[model samples]
Target: MKHPRLFLHVQEPALAAQLLQSAVVKRFIVVKSSDAAPWSEQLLQQSCDLAFIQADQHSEADYQQLLSSNILAEMDFIFVSDGNPEPWLDKLMRSGAGYHFRQPLDMVCILDTLQDFYQQLSSTQQQVKANNSMLDQFGLLVGSSRSMLKLYRTLRKVAVTEANILIVGESGAGKELVANTVHLASYRAEQPFIAINCGALSPELVDSELFGHTKGAFTGALRDHQGVFAQAEGGTLFLDEVTEMPIEQQVKLLRVLESGEYRPVGSDKCRQANVRIVAATNRDPQQAISDGLLREDLYFRLAQFPVVVPPLRDRNDDIVGLAQHFLAYRNAQEQQQKQLSTATLQLIAEHRWPGNVRELKHAVERAYILADKMIEPDHLLLEMALADTTETELNEVPAGVPLEQLEKAAILNTLEQNAGNKTDSAQQLGISVKTLYNKLEKYQQTEP
Candidate 1:
């Protein structure tokens, strides 16, 4: 998140200079006002989180006018003065003046107060979620839960607009599917839909992969390669795990969004883009910005419409229905009427699916394989918590369990936890992505 903005009405030069140099004050966006400019006029113009006004310095009429300013309703006010504010405390509190303080200020307590004020602001912002709306199906999504219905309702309105969309959700909550739904439900339904995982690409290749490269652009440029934008012209482009994109690459993306134009690498020729941009991240957008994983400016440009997909835990009511849907597809392939046991259904309802829908689908697949007539809870691996599945398996291994088998299982489980994000999987395993890729290839070759 961007730093909380403070409207610091500085009257004393020494305190202003001290505040500017202090480490405590550097945490905020401080906007100083010292001249005789009306506080109400200035407050009306800029968006501020907190207003520190010298209430006693002005006349009673000026104080009353400041309190009457409509902007104060949206802002938290801390009235400052050298005199006692006891007489005006009741009236000040009624007008949204949350705090009052005398001169010889305690800067130490100020930081703690700011933290509390920030929390209040954060709580208000989180009050508007999609769970209050309604719908049963939209594109590839299938769920009867309130959040799923709300998501469907949100997507319907979002798809009509040409503005960019940002989808935020936990891993395996089907953000890409939501992006596809946005495309399919929009006027661009018949157009190409291109999807790429930002985390899956290396830093050096991001530019070439995104904007295309002309033949002989670099040493390994065998032929001209068309990028996602060119391939997805007049369509939709889904960027998954966008927070994992390098900070430098984010600048290029911001430029494209602003201008709707880009030049292929090594070619001076510029191209206009007709593609709709849709980005997704498993992390909170505000936290990602504060952590420097995502750019603030780019975030505002892309998050014109943000759709948050509900995690499986929040939509547990739909778990059985989704499992049956997956099983039906698998059963069709096997040409058999396979079914889940009552115990398996009970376990599915009770267990917390930390990895969300992807983990649930994988569990269903495993159950299908292990059971001939009826899939049981033992086959689902729901006995242990989803987060502990890998650790439990590792700890309970028999004496003769092969190291290669254990290693493969750990790698596969980690990959599932990350929703098949190879870069993240590699990082978690403390191995290079090249090694991870090699092992995956070996697993494919050796599998019976």
Candidate 2:
């Protein structure tokens, strides 16, 4: 009564009848002929949960035909192979069979195995449903541009393995998006994905934030804390702006990467950390090393599988697609739909997006909020990009300007504009709040 129906693809009448006698199998379909293809299709159409295919009872031709049929595609196949099951079991498993059993089945063992299989099948179905729901909400990466295609291919290749990845690009270059895609495609998709910015914390606080600390480790340490490493165990730990980590902390981080072990500050016991590190840095790590900002050894350790996320400016062909994508995203967030005009898209494509995808995203968000009807070129505000340059130059300069000064100016402007709200300033700047604090500290130290 537990299972309403079960299908048995067995030519042996005695075995079929004995199996049907079980209290769980209320309804049964027994295939007694080699040409039982129509029955198989009918069983599938009827939504049979389990299919027992007896290899010994059926002819080789019949087995081959069933295996090749589309009816078996969605079904969970339980193959009952003969005594020496190595060859047949291998073939069946490779051909998408879920479970296998040897001949001369023990009733007790068969019942137990079926119960376990039912539980597993239910769990798998639930997981697939959840995944489909998430995909529907997030939407797939939708671009056919050569750069996007290349990035997609690379992401697929890297997702199957366990390796440290370093995503390098200028700010707004979609580094985090790439990291998410890597996680989604990887074997650890079901595991926790925790992201932290090394550039966001001070040298004194970065260690405790990453590896945690015991109670009373520092002035305000209230209780024993589980840092990002512990939180990201068996999953991914995405370190954004890794080059911003102070040199001293980099040495400790390098040790953790090499040994897969770390201890909380003011604690003697070492904890195992099985996190996959995927670091992203806008700064040139090699240059950072040369400038005595980042440790070279740490850079090498983190760069096990380095990937450069191309800047938006470099992928001009993807602009329209990305713009539409952003507009759709904004529309969903604001609960209103909008479209971009051809002239509007053309203007967007013409600009030099020094801030990269982050800048483009901000642009779209601002336009969405401000536009009364259809989004036009005039509705777009390039002030975030323009604030970095002088008003005269912003109007006169035909070519693009250096981004470093622009970035610095933009950061300062946001800080002042937000009344020193570091979190909001960081959000507007497209950098971590920790990075904003670091910049503030740096500015104070060198202030005249």
Best by lDDT: 1
State candidate 2's TM-score: 0.58
**Model 1 CA deviation exceeding 4 Å by range:** 1-136, 383-412, 416-424, 427-448
Weakest 10 consecutive residues, lDDT, candidate 2?
Answer: 130-139
Residues 1-448 of candidate 1: C-alpha lDDT, one tens digit per residue: 4466788776667766766676645766888774566766676677887776665545365466655665543566676667665454446555435677666788767656766555334312222222321223457776766477556656755675687899999877888779988999888999999987787678988999999999999999999999999999999999988999999999999999999999899999999999999999999999999999999999999897677899999997678867776787678767878888888888888877777887777678666755678888887755543356575564544556567865766676687767667778899889988688678657544521
- lDDT by candidate, in order shown: 0.74, 0.66
Please give the lDDT score at residue 87 for candidate 2: 52
Tell me how candidate 1 scores on lDDT. 0.74
Task: Output the lDDT of residue 271, model 2.
Answer: 96
Clashes counted in candidate 1 amount to 0
Please provide, for model 2 over 1-448, each residue's C-alpha lDDT reduced to its tens digit, 9 standing for 90 to 100.
Answer: 2332356776568767766676544333333334635444545455555677666633455455556665444455666667664554465565445667776777677766665545333312111111112111111344444465445545555555676888888766767767777787777888998877676777778878899999999899999988999998888999987877887788889999999999999899999998888999877878878899878788788886678878777777667656777787666665776878888889899988666665665566556655666988765666443336467645642245456544555575465445334567788778887567666556434421
